[model samples]
Target: MGWIYLILAGCFEVVGVTGMNKVIKNKNVQAYMILFTGFIFSFGFLSLAMRTLPLGLSYAVWTGIGTVGGTIVGMLYYGDSKDWRRILFIAMIVIAVMGLKLTSS
Candidate 1:
């Protein structure tokens, strides 16, 4: 259940970041709304998860997942670079996040 919150937090972070990009370009009103709502939900869920989760571990997992998620969102939604090296690094981030979660769990 806590892990579910963390994953949802990551998804919300991705939505927030991608919507922020669109909002910055003044290209999407809906994305702006999504951005605002996503941040609210992400933080809310993270706060809830923190109730039972260790601060250091939760923060690390949250940040790592969010970073990878944001990068993928950037690439898919904004046509950002998608080179092999970048993908590999993102995969590493996922692995690290998973390792941390597993170790901490």
Candidate 2:
């Protein structure tokens, strides 16, 4: 349950970041609203997940998910650089996040 909440938090983090990008590019009020809501829900879920997960482990995973998800979002939707090196690094982050999850008790 805690892990579920953490995963949801990470997803919301991606939403917030993507919203930020949209707001910056187009100055859309709806994008700003999404950014605000996403952050609020992200933090709220993260706090709930902390009830069972270790602080360090939970934080690392949450940020890892956000980093990877945001990078993909940028590439797919925002036309970010799609260099091989960037993709490789994103893959590395995914591996590390999985490793952390597998090792956690």
Total clashing pairs for each candidate = 0, 0
Q: Model 1 scores what on Cα lDDT?
A: 0.84
lDDT of 2 at 10: 98
**Candidate 1: tens digits of C-alpha lDDT, residues 14-61:** 778877877888867797798899899889888888888888888888
After superposing all C-alphas onto the true structure, candidate 2 shows an RMSD in angstroms of 0.9
lDDT value, residue 102 of candidate 1: 78
State the C-alpha lDDT per candidate. 0.84, 0.94
* Model 2 stretches astray by more than 4 angstroms: none
| lDDT of residue 7 for candidate 2 | 98
TM-score of each: 0.91, 0.95
Considering summed lDDT, which 10 consecutive residues are worst modelled in model 2?
A: 19-28
What TM value does model 2 have? 0.95
Would you list the clashing residue pairs of candidate 1?
A: none
| Per-model RMSD to reference | 1.4, 0.9
